[model samples]
Target: MSDFGLGVSGLAAMFALMILRMPVGMAMLAVGYFGIVIMNGDRSANALLVTEAFSATANYSLTVIPLFILMGNIASATGFSRRLYEAAFAWVGGLRGGLASASIVGCAAFSAVSGSSVATAVTIGKVALPEMKRFGYSDALATGSIAAGGTLGFLIPPSTGFVLYAILTEESIGQLFMAGILPGLLLTALFMITVTLVTLRNPEAGPRGAAVSWPERMRAVLRAAPLLAIILTSIGGIYFGVFTPVEAAGIGAGLIILMALVMGKLPWGVLTDAVLDTVRTTAMLYLIIIGASVLNPFLALTQVPATLGEGLTSLGLGPYGVLLAIVVIYLLLGMFMDGLAMLVVTIPIFFPIMTGLGFDPIWFGVVAVILIEMGMITPPVGLNVFVVKSVAKDVPMSTIFRGVLPFWFAMAACLLLIVVFPQIAVMIPQAMFR
Candidate 1:
C-alpha cells in the first residue's frame, strides 16, 4: 500500500480501538508500532521504538512535568483552591450569576498553579460545586461553570499543553510560556463575559446575594495572596529569564511545599497522596509522549503530511485559510478524542504545516492550546465535562453540556480575536525574546 493509504488505515484502526475503550496511549502505541513494522521490517521498528521511548522519557527537561504537576497537587491538597473560590466569591457574589462567574475566575487562578485540565475540573469542582449549590445555584450552572472553567488550566501559564508544545516543536518553553499570557487572560475575560451575559438573560441562574464591603474584599484578596504570588513567581520568573522553565517549576514546587508546611496544611498523609497522584499523572503523560515520539518518525518517513502541506501551499489558500482548516479539524477531532492524545497525535503533522505556511510557532502554540481549551468543554468526550460529571452525578451530562454552550461561544470569540490580531498571542514572546 502507498504510505498515504497506510497512514489512513492506521488512523482508522486507532480510532476503532479508542471506540472500544482502549487506553489512548496504548492504542496509539499499538497502531504506530505495527504501522512502523509494516512499513519497515520488524527489527528496525523494534529498535526505533526502544530508542524513542528511552530518549523521550529520560530527557532531563521532561522532569519539569512531574515538578510542575507536584506543585499543583500540593497546592490543591493544601486548600488553595478553596481560598481562590472564596476570594472570587467575595468580590462577585452580589452580582447576578456572580457565584458562577467567580467560579470561572477562581478556576483561572487555580489554572495558574494547576496546569492539567481534568485536574483543575476535579479540584475546583470539589471546592466550588457544593458552595454554588448551597447558594441556590442550579445543577446546570454550577456543574457547567466548573467544567468550562477547568479548561483554563490548559491555557494559563504553567500549562502542560504549552510545555508539551514546546517539546514537540523544539521551541523555548520560556517563550511559549510568555506567549500564553495574553491569550490566557483573554480566555478568562471571555469566560467571565459569558457568565455575566447568561445572568443578565436569566437572573434565576444567579440569585441575588449580599455584597462584600471593601475591607472584606481586601481581606479576601489577602487570603488569596499566596496563589497570586505563586503564579507571578513561577510565570514571571520564567518570562524575565530569572529561571529556566524547569527551574521555575522547581521553585514553584518548593514554595508550595513550604507554604503548606508553614500553614500546617501539609500533613504526611496529604504529602504522600500528592506524590502518588503526581507520579500517576506524569507516567500517563510520558506514555503518551513516548508513543508520539515512536509514531512521529514513522509518519515523517511516510512523507504524506509533507506532500499534503506542499499541496495546500501550492493551492494558495494562504496562511489564514490553512490555520482555519487546522482549527476546524482540531475541533472535530476533539469531539471524539482526548485533548492531550489528539495534540500528541496531530501536532507532528500540523505544526510543520503551520510553520511551512509562515505562521509563528509561539503564536500557533497558543492557538493550539486555545483549541484544546475548547475541547475540554465540548461534547461527547470533553474531559473536563466528564470530570465534573463524575463529581456531580446528580447533573446529567447533557445539562452540563448545555450550561457550557455560552462559554464555548465566548471561547470561539477569543479564538477569532487571536486569529485577527496575531499580536495578541505573539507580542509578549517577541518582546521578551528580542
Candidate 2:
C-alpha cells in the first residue's frame, strides 16, 4: 500500500478504536506505533515510543499545564468562581435577560482563571443557575447562557486549547495567548447581545431581578477584584514580555494559593484536593500530547500532509477558499468528536496547509480554537451542553441544546468577523511582539 493509503488506514483504525470507547491517547498511540513499525522497524518504533513519552512528560514548557490547572482548580476550590458570578450578577442582573447576560460575563471572568470549558460551565452553572431559577428565568435562556459562556474557557487567556495548539504547532504560546484576548472579549460581548435579543423577543424568557444599589455594585466589584487582578497580571505579564508563559503560570498559581491562604480559604483538605485535580488533569493532557507526538511522526513518515496539501493546492481553490472548506470540516467534526481529540488528530494534517497558504499561525490558532469552542456547544456532542445539563439536571437535554442555538450563531458571526478582520485576532500579538 502507498504511504498515503497506510496513513488513511491508520486514521480509520484510530477512529474505530475511539468509537469502541478506547481512550483517545491510547488509540492514537496504538495506531501510531504499529504504523511506524510497519513502515520503519520495531526497533525504531520502540525507540520512538520511549523517547516521545519521556520528552512529552519531561518538557519544562509543559509544566505550565499543571500550574495553570492548579491555579484554576484552586480558584474553584476556594469559591473564587462564585464571587465572580456574584460580581457580574450585581452589575447586570436587573436588566432584561440580565441574569443570562451576567452568566456570560461571569463565565468569561471565571474562564480567565479556569481554562477548561467544562470547569467553567460547571463552576459558573452552579452559581448562576440557582439565581436565574429563583428569578423565574426561562430554562432555555438560563441554561443556554451557561453552556455558551462556558466555551469562553477555550478562547480566553490561560487557555489550555491555545497552550496545546502552541505545543503542537511550535507557535509562541505568548503570541497565541495574546491573539485570543480581543477575539475572546468580542465573542463574550456577542453572547451577551444574544441574550439581550432573546429576552427582547420574549420578555418572559428572562425577567429582571431586583436592582442593586451603586454601593452594592461597588462592593461586589471589590470582592471579585483580586481574581480579576490575577488574570490581568498573569496574562498581561506574558504579553508585555515581563514573563515567559511558564513563569506567568507559576506566578498565577502561586498568587492564587497565597490569596487563598491569606483569606483562610485554603484549608489543608481543599488544597490537597485541588493539587490532586491538577495532577489528574495534567496527566490526561500529557497523554494526549504524547499520543499526538507519536502519531505526528507516523503521519510524517506516511507523507499524508504533503499529499493532502498538494491535492488541495491543485484544486485551484485559493487560500481563503481552502481555509473555508477546512473550517466547514471542523464544524462537522465538532458535532461528533471531542474538541481536544479533533485538535490532536487534525492539526497534524491541517496546520501545515494553513501556514503554507500564508495564514498567520497565531491568528489561525485563535480561529481554530474558536471553532473548537463552537463545537463544545454544537449539538449531539456539545460537551458544554451536557455539562450544563449535569448542573441543571431538571432541564431537558433538548432544551439546553435549543438554548445554545442563538449563541452558536453568535460564535459563527465572531468567526466570520475574525476572518474578515484577521487583525481582530492577530493585532494584539503583532503589537506585543513588535
Tens digits of lDDT, candidate 2, 107-183: 99988888888899999999999999999999999999999999999999889999889889888888888888999
Report the CA-based lDDT of candidate 2 relative to the real structure.
0.92
Error of 1 at 84 (Å): 1.3
Query: lDDT of each prediction vs. the true structure?
Result: 0.86, 0.92
Over the stretch 124-164, how does candidate 1's per-residue lDDT look in tens digits?
89988887888787787888788988998898878899888
Q: TM-score for every candidate vs. truth? A: 0.97, 0.99
Candidate that would win on lDDT: 2
- State each model's C-alpha RMSD to the native: 1.3, 0.9
Clashing pairs in 2: none
- Residue 250 shift from truth in candidate 1, angstroms: 0.4
